[model samples]
Target: MNLDTPIEYLKGVGQQKAELLKKELGVYTFNDLLQHFPFRYVDRTRFYKIREVSADMPSVQVIGRVLSKEIIGEKQSRRLVAQLKDDTGVLELVWFQGIRWADKLVQPGAVFIVFGKPTEFNGRFSISHPELELYNPSAVKQGNLTLQPVYNSTEKLKQSFLDTKSLQRLQASALEIVGRSIQETIPDYLRSKHRLLNKADAIQQIHFPQNPNSLEAARHRLKFEELFFIQLKLLRNKLLRTGKFRGLLFGQVGEKFNAFYSDKLPFDLTNAQKKVLKEIRQDTQKGIQMNRLLQGDVGSGKTVVALMSMLLAIDNGFQTCMMAPTEILAKQHYASLEKMMGQGFINMALLCGSTPKKERRIIHQALQDGSLNILVGTHALIEDEVQFKNLGLAVIDEQHRFGVEQRAKLWRKNSVPPHVLVMTATPIPRTLAMTLYGDLDISVINELPAGRKPIKTIHLFESQRLRMFGFMRQEIAKGRQVYIVYPLIKESEKLDLLYLEAGIEAISREFPLPQYRISIVHGKLKAADKDFEMQRFVKGETQIMVATTVIEVGVNVPNASVMIIENAERFGLSQLHQLRGRVGRGAEQSYCVLMSGNKLSREARIRLQTMVKTNDGFEISETDLQLRGPGNIEGTQQSGVLDLKLADLAHDQHILQEARDAVIRIFEDDPELNTDKNVLLKEYFLRKTPAISWNKIS
Candidate 1:
């Protein structure tokens, strides 16, 4: 038997059991099971009598005889109840599930060893769903007593008689078959330098540790290995792209860029923006493909920087394309460009899924004929039919929404890939960015443009609704519009749509017709209808815009000075920050009111508190990372790259840094990893390289 052997061949796991294992735990082969590391372990060295078991104990192992067993109650409330007795006292065994199976195992006058935590009820102690095994004095051996591994399993697996104990038995059998055959993955020199345990020993110790010290050693070695490979992949991708890829050279900053900077400029260039432009210019001037990630907070002038970068491409006799995630965002960008450049100074067109067929044909013709200098669109931009005549640079807005492949399609447009500039208003923590976007060079536009006031953020309980309404009235009285947003549009079942619909009604009553006009929007609305409502708010024809979080990343309504998010506790921190960003776009002193019920979970409270404490998206993101972990933060870049089983970004940032440093050190000595000392590392990557996905482009 080997790592590649099907799991059904294992002693206890037959065809039926293997199917359950695969369905429940995603384990189908011996190697998959081996890598299914234990979430925790339990000490099973001591035994206790019934008298020794107490309510305060975490768990106690007791050898006792079952006095009686029976199934009580009917249907949903049915349970298997049994009585067990030792020399001193009796313990109750209860099973809320698996009643028939448990009843058969628990027979009267049968002696068994039971293990579970004891709970007190009415002056008596009982153990629920305790681990039970038939006691055999002769079968028990000294070597068998060790730390028992507790695998993360499902209720279905348990019902199929594959509980933690069953999994442990299967693991033991697996180790016996593939024991010493487990090849060393990391190099011996690196292991020795890091004081890590050997691969075989680490894998063995992790599953069935002899002692706590050994378990700790195993953990360190395995965690290091996991993170090391990730860093190696990221660094190597960067090394390869920078070394092999050629970029289109933009030798001069010409008429369009100069005209925009001097003639059409709206605001003075912030220092941060100037610094970032310098970086982009340097990358494009040199004949190296630029894969850069531009990060900034909302209203921090990322769009201005993006526009200027595109202009640089245009100035150098090359075309540019800017892609946004939604039609609303794409139109907003096109409008900004139009307002800045005026009509016909530079030919530009917008293409979306909803664009009229005739306009699409004209835009397509312009792109191929070299007349379209800049094309702005949603995912439609990546479609095969649309082609650029001389695409030099590609700017992606809210870039995390696009997959690596979708972005790669833009690179595939030209003979040599364009200089890629990825922009995101959602803040990514340093550690997460290093792991996810490590291949790309990063620039931060950290400060807002001049004359923009810091948005005032406030947290309010449901009881303070009237006060929030009063503040909104005051803001609207100043000729500024108000945005009253509900939690999420996706969960129309969560009654949020109901809340938004009812909210518009209530607002109609509060500040009745003629005096006030409210525009309603959500995902369910038709595209034309949504656009109509959005335009109403933008044009200041409506004093209030009531909608779901569909307004999270869209139109810039500078007149919308107040943002009131109802049921704010339901939203994630990053999202809450993004929603708050909707109102603060204008020069007026904007306010974000987060409204929630009085009762809140600890996590919910922390999220609300973080929003109120600061407008810094990065700090809020760090706290959000700590609270919701890396996977769910603002629907963090959905890529297979972050499918980590063990190492956590929140708690293991130090280890990640150390691992990254180690990779950098390796590349310094042998960038190609072709040296004799690094031969093993080279071979490992070669063996593991199965058609690469993310290694090609950022």
Candidate 2:
């Protein structure tokens, strides 16, 4: 049988078992079963005495005789209790489930093997629902395995009598059926040079390891292979894009750009901004398509860089567009840019879902006639009715919120394709950026703007509500606005909204409406209503804006100086950082109060402490990566993050770096992979191309 043989064709896996495997573990073929490596290994070479079994022991195995069995309790409390003796001592074995079935096999003086965790009750040790096995001296002597592999199993699989033991049997059977016949995926030369185990042996040893050393070798081989292919794929795409596409040339910084920079620029560009602008200029001048990711902290001047880049396009007589995920952010960008554009003879328009039909028509006409130099909007910009005259550069804000297809639509707007620049305020950990955005050249705005005071972060318990409220009153008295952010947990959205409404009522009582002028906003609010509330807050018509996480993205209000986050512990570290970013935009010293309950988990405490300690986004991102794995990071869900089965991005960075370097070396040897030594690499990719790859677009 081949590796692709249906799993049901195996010796013992019937259709029933095969379906269970597929549904439970996504294992449908022999190869899949083989690749489903064990999470941990247990030594089975020795057995412990019953007398030596302590309550503190993780697990223990003992060969004993079932001396007595009795059905204890009744109904839901029913249990099967038995006394087992192993020459040294008598031990209590109890089964809270399957009493009828358990009482039969375990009878008087029947020799059996028992294994489970030992727990003490009333100073007596007992095993609850221990795994029972028939003792066989001949089978014990015949078995050559020194260690046993433990695999993850679902409750449904266990219910079908297909537990970890059954999974282990299937793995062993898979190896036996396909043993040496398991074809290698990695090239032999690379494996040999790297001292990696062959694919076949690695698969076998990973399932049933002979020793710890061999197991480690097998893990290193598999992890390297997984990460190696990914890096190769991303790097290859990057090289292909850079070499293949000829971008629109914005050769020189012209009039509009010069006018805005020298005359109307608010503050001198930070060195970080100048470096990134230089990179863009260099990329644009080379006539190669630019697909670059610009990462900055929340308050970093990325918008300014984007504006300057767009101005370069305008100077070269080309149109530009910037797409934000939401209308609020779109309008915010439009307003900010309008103020920045000032007296410059630059024509810009904003288009969104809420744009009036007349304005949309005017926008369409301006865009089609080449009068509009820049268009900033939401998904409405990509609508069929709205088209750019000569699209030269497209800047996608919070790029992860848009799908590959959406971004592709923008790319297709121009025949030669504009230089695509993706801007994200979410600081990506270096390891994540390596794997997720490796195809795009990354430039980070590591430095915050000068003269901006760091947000004063404080952690407080719920009992300090009076203090928090009084502090809010003090801030409000100083003519500064306040933002009270409440987390809208998805599982209980309605409950959270109700809690938010209750909070609004309480705040009104405390501050007294008419005089307080608090604006309430949440996900449930209608778009028009939410916009009205947001506008009210932004225009200073409201003293406090109470909202959910909806405002976490791009609601820019320089006057809002204090941010109060309720249930701060419920928010992720990156999320807390983002919410805190809302306040510190102004020159005034701002404060972020993280209000949480009394009880806090160790991880939650660390997250709060990290927030209170530093204002560096990269540092906070690293801590967030440690506290909550790479999965929950905002944009990485679809960026090859889930495909990782074994490699820990937080800890296996060394292996990832090694794999990346190896890919580079391969490219250096034969860029096209046409050489005899690299043909296997191409073959490997041909057999395992992903359904959708991020390398295709920004």
Candidate 3:
């Protein structure tokens, strides 16, 4: 069978089996079959006697003769008991609910090789459900043994007689095809410099390694190619964006920027804020389309920098649109910007999805007539019906909430794609920044504003809940607002929300005074209700806001001075930090209370300890990246974060840097991979994979 042929065309695969394989393993093509590498390997070459087995070891292999085999119970819950004896000692082999088959296979006085984890039960050593292979004395004496590969299988596939062995047979057939069909993808120079193996060799070694060194070499080669293609795609997009798109040339318009800082501003800009603003100004004046990412910790003054850039767009007589992920955030930006720029400094309009049709029509007419200077909204601003008069800049807040196509729609609203400025409160690790946002310029606001007190973070066990409540009462008595957050919005399949509900009910019981208002917000609440609840908190009408992570992104309450997160162990470090950021915005001395349960894992304890030690977002992000790895740093699919299959953004930074350098060097020498020896390299990128769509990359 050819690598490009349908998988059903392979030997011994029928229609029903092909459908099951496709659904269970995503194997529709021969190429897919070849790439299904084993999760782990079991070495049969190292065999230990029964007496040499220890309880502390994970697993062991033994060869012995079966002295007796019997069923211990009724047919429903029967167990097979086999007593095996070796020259050293006798061992018991047990299998649950499969006695009939075990009885037929293992007869008295028959020698067999068994492999399994040894466990101590009732003061006796036993191996439960050990895998058995009939022993051949002559073959065993020859020392001819192999490593057995284990693959992840589903229940349906296993029931259909497509277990690991069946899958291995299919893989063996596919590998034979790959050996003759597939070609090497890396150029000779790169392969030699990196000491890499060919594609076919790497695939074979990864599945059936001769030694650990071979496995390492196979892994390195595959990971390098995966990362190289990702970087190349990002770099190409960046090059196309800068070379093709036109941006408004607002050269050296620091007068308006200075005016806003000197006359209209309320607080002094932090050094980090100043630096990021300068970067934005330079990008705006360069006349090239600005695809920049504004990354900072929560409450690091990203909004102020965004507003300053919007003002620059206004000064250049070009209308700007700022899109927020939610209506509450959009409204918050509208109120804050109006307060900063005065009522009529710029004609600002809010065009949300829920905006009345009459108001939307008015906003649409004003935008097309060049009357509205600034517009803020949710996804409504990107509707095709909404036209812009010389749209110069598009600012997206909390960029992780939107996809690439969604952002591109906003750009297409204008004649030429508007200069894009994406902002996020989530601090991205440096390595992930290189791979995910390689097409964008990065500006980080690492420092908080002056006079803003650092939020004191502390972790308390669940047993200390009462003391935490008492402390909360004291903080409330001192006239400071509090935010008590839960990790879940409601009951889930994986987790119970009983603790969260109990905490909310307990707070209500303790603080029953009508004079003190308590508001609730969660994902299950309707959008309008959620917005109203947040508005109450923002207006200081609610002294305590009980919420879930729905408030983690854009609910700005400067008056809220305390944040209490229940079951903090359930959250990632970055999430805990973001929730803690809800407070400490005001001039008050804010505090974060992390309540965790007992018996936290080592990684969980480290995450909590990191939260208690510092408030720097960048440092916390680095710690989070190291602890959780990059696969989960930005969450999974629908999270707008790049999903890398092999490259660990935390551990693969050096590899990514080298691959980026190589790509740059190649382009500098030859714009296209058209050289005689580089042909294979070009063909490799054209091949499709499960993680990335070919059309998206091409």
Candidate 4:
């Protein structure tokens, strides 16, 4: 048998089982089934007497004879119950969901082995929906108990009689045929050096381990293999792209850049900003394609560094463009650049979807005529007609918000493609960044600018509303603006909007009219109306911006000192971090008030406590990863690069780092893997490389 043999042909996996496996688990061939490792394992050697079972025990295994079996309850609520007894005492075993098939397996006077968590009700112990099998002395060994693999299954699969035991049996059957035929995927020398098991042995032991030591060895081998391949693929693509693509060399800091540094600069560049610029300068001058990810916290000076980099491109006689996820943000960037650079000195224009046809026509003409030195806009900047004469640099803000195809369209604006600088305010953990954007060079501005105070975050219960309002009044009395944000639940936007509107009404009644102005924004508003409401907040016409999370990203008001997030427990750690970020942009002390209900879950309490503990985005991000897992972390989930099976980003950082280092060493010795020693590694990646569009990663 071969790895590619159809799973349907495997013993015990008939057509129906094969179809179910393929639909529920994505298993198509023997190779896929072999790779479907168990999520957890249960110890089978130790069996407990009925009296030993306690409610506090996690899961217990007991072997007992069935004393009585009967069906209880009426239709729909019907269930099967059996009284099981051992030498110590009697225990109740019950099944609520699957009755017919369960009735057949359970019979009076029959011996059985069962495993499940024990629960106490009415001074008696019982196990519900426990896994059971007919007790056979021949199947039991004389030595210590061994671990049994447990596979994840869906309700449909369980209803169809394909439980974890059935899956384990099917895997064992498939292994019997292909164990001898399987070949080593990793090289012999490297496997020996790393003390890893061979591919076949690891696969066998992972499914059915004989001991704890073998299971650990099997896990190490599989995790190492999984991570090593991912790192190798990422590094190989990076090397290939560097060799294939040539960039516009900005060889000198010409007049434009120099003038901007000396004349147009607002403040002294922070050490972090200076270091990032040096890295960008080096990449631009090297004449290799520059795809860099710039990460910073909320008040960090990323905008200035991006603007200065654009000046380097302009100094080299090439035009530049910046794209933001929202039109409000695009407009903000356009305005900030215009104010800082002076209008006529560098011809810049905004080309969002809201731009008028007449102005767009003029901007289009100037872009073709090589007069528009810089352009800032939303996705509208990538339109077919929006062409640049000499696009040398393209800076994307909140880069994860745009899809790979959308960003790829910007790259195609020029024949050779411009050097890309993708920036994000949501700080990515180092391990996540290396895996998600591993092909791109990463530069992090870890320090906030001088004189900016860290946002002081506090968690308050809803019962403290009067005190919260008093604090808001005090901040407003100090001539600082406030933001009151509400969450939008998916079940009902109208209900959420009603809550937001009610918040506005309550705030207006408290602050009362002539002395205060309130502006609201939400997803239901039209684009123009939303922009107008945002403008009112920016212009200080409104002392308070009462809105939903619509104001999460782009609204930047330096005068805004307080952000009160109502029902903050409903927000994720990342979103809560982002909302906290909205406040601390200005130089003066700012505060983030996380208003949650008193009855918060443990996870929600941790999120709020994390927020209250640190203002560092990276720290909050790591906590968020721990609390929510990598799949829920915003960009990594959608990137399709984090589909890890055995290697976890949170727990297995050491393995990931080792994998990356090994790839570097391998490539340093054999760049193309053309040597005889590395031929197996080359063939392995080639065989496993899926049709992934790596270009959109930037």
TM-score (all chains, Cα) for each model: 0.89, 0.91, 0.91, 0.91
Sort the predicted structures by lDDT, highest score first. Answer: 4, 1, 2, 3
lDDT of 1 by residue, 1-22 (tens): 8998999999988999999989
| TM-score, model 3 to reference | 0.91
Q: Of the candidates numbered 2 and 4, which has the greater lDDT value?
A: 4
lDDT against true structure, model 1: 0.87
Candidate 4: give the clashing pairs. 45-145
Native-to-model Cα distance after best TM-score fit, residue 337 in candidate 4, in Å: 1.6
Please report how far candidate 1 places residue 167 from its true position, in Å: 0.8
Backbone N/Cα/C clashes per model: 0, 0, 0, 1
Q: Which RMSD values do the candidates have, in order?
A: 4.1, 3.3, 3.2, 3.5
lDDT of 4 by residue, 230-250 (tens): 888888778877877888898
Residue-wise C-alpha lDDT for candidate 3, range 358-390, written one tens digit per residue: 999999999999999889999998888999988
Q: Taking the tens digit of each residue's C-alpha lDDT, what string does model 2 give over 494-549? A: 43332576677788899996788998888898998998999999999999999999
Q: Which stretches of candidate 1 lie over 4 Å from their true place?
A: 43-114, 120-125, 129-146, 488-498, 635-637, 693-698
Please list the C-alpha lDDT of all candidates, in the order they appear: 0.87, 0.87, 0.82, 0.88
In Å, residue 180's CA in model 3 sits off its true spot by 1.9
